[model samples]
Target: MAESTTIEYLCKFCRAVVEVFGPQYLRSPNAEDTTRILAQNEAREFYGMLGSIDCLHWAWKNCPFAWQGMYKGAKGGCSVCSNVFAKLVEGHAPPVNFKVNGRQYNKGYYLADGIYPRWSTFVKTISNPVPGGKNSYFAKCQEACRKDVEQAFGVLKSLFAVVRQGPLAAVDHQVPVAWAAFLNMRQEIRDPQVHQELQKDLVEHLWRLKGNA
Candidate 1:
């Protein structure tokens, strides 16, 4: 057999490692994980929050002509959500019970921005919040915490540049694994009613936590 080029050999090695350890390490959060996430978020006045959510854009300049449309966003650039984020969305959403203003919520949430849908899992910053009000305070805290999500994305990308740089063939080979593991992308994540309720609770919760201080 002919010897593979450096990039080809590296791709093969990376593929093998991902195949073996991806399921174990790339896996979703569990009960213990949620507990830790909750404690950390609660310290920030966001009870029952798992983390923040946001997507970044990358220019896939060499994207296939036929696939460019799919990759293109409104501004004509490619946007990709982090793989770890996919795991969280498709992963097991444990019942994270918590109370705010005497109201209870069962599922955890992520601090997002206006671009995202108003889903139960996403707690977006209040837009144009009235000055010196609970909404203003809540927006301040939520947006501040949300800033960390992008930094985390940067760190992950730096560590896993291979996954982003692998040749088309290697990426194609691994895409199926992600799809196969997608248990409930839509049903589990989209809950508008719950989102509204959760948002209300959070606004009140944060206001009480810091508004008076």
Candidate 2:
């Protein structure tokens, strides 16, 4: 149950990480996320849901040997952006394929914390949520659904027990040259309009789905 770099092999890593994913691991169905059914089953409000993102700091399981020098942080390499989830913001992750509360959303969102940028793809819980209103009810449902992410990570750590795994995380590194792409990515993540709309839609959707229950 120990995760290490010295253990260089295929079958072990495959069985641990690959087989766990199968074909659905790399190639999602029709350019959409793979966790829609599971997430929706967990909560109807998560109709077009991806998976939850948390703030649990994880060691970078695999950092490029050359970049390790610049990637040191309190938690190993801080939190590196996973390609699987990074695709969400990169404009290639998913298409506008699902409808929630009558509105269409292209990107399936992850449940993140307030530390993350306000992007449509990341949803965070309300702080000091006033109880008994939509805010309170939405907060309750969001928190409940987020528990699955915690348990999922627990299983991942148990299986590969080395570097902790973050579902979707950001990194702190300073070696960049692509100003064009960087600016664009920054623009998208900082869009308050999109974040506001997504949060509103999610609040309405979750309220309708579980508020009465």
Candidate 3:
């Protein structure tokens, strides 16, 4: 009975997401908007980038002990790992016009961490960046940009108390519902003054680190 109920609820939630919010909140950007995205990326010194890519785990507090081994890891909880990437670049598509070091390319990229595979589409910070050089600068910038994903997660968890409860402990089943909520929430808090102030402080801190390096 519980299994059937879970399935039914998941279906209804997913359907509602697609019918109501998918078109507006869950789409890749059209080509016309690419220029704006490029400008934003250039400001962060990451030309041709769409956004940061990362994952977030939503813990299943009531997960069955039998299956816990599969879902549980060092994190000490049975959790569902959500691909927390697409939402960040919603309305942004790939095959973007990118230029770096005077060379032009035609693919957008995401700043990611080391666990992700090395691909042209994902830029990982230097594990051991050489100090006082291009690698150090790039590493700093890459990490700074990558925080967009983290901030998005933080925003969702902080703003939505219900959502903070591991997506109602059915995150694996209600991904669409969670994503819909996140999309709506993102628009509401696009860029508050406090975030801008914090960003400025971070930029200054990075510059100081660069100078010291």
C-alpha lDDT score of every prediction, in listed order? 0.69, 0.61, 0.57
Question: What are the clash counts of all predictions, listed in order?
Answer: 0, 0, 2
How many steric overlaps does candidate 3 have?
A: 2
How many backbone overlaps does candidate 1 show? Answer: 0
Top model number, lDDT: 1
Enumerate residue pairs that collide in model 3: 29-91, 29-92
Preferred candidate (lDDT higher): 2 or 3: 2
**Model 3 regions lying over 4 Å from their true place:** 1-17, 32-35, 55-94, 160-213
TM-score of each: 0.71, 0.62, 0.52
Write one digit per residue (lDDT tens) for candidate 3, span 12-128.
Answer: 987786567655544445565667767887776566666655434566789998999888744377776554434333423334665454455555656667755444555666678
lDDT of 1 by residue, 90-186 (tens): 4445558898778877667778778778887788888999999989988888888877766776677688764344322221112323555565555
**Candidate 2 lDDT, tens digit per residue, 116-208?**
668766777888887798888888877777777668767877785332554321332343346676577657666777777878887898787
- Name the top TM-score candidate: 1
Model 3 residue 90 CA deviation (Å) reads 17
Give the per-residue Cα lDDT of candidate 1 at 76. 57
Clashing pairs in 2: none
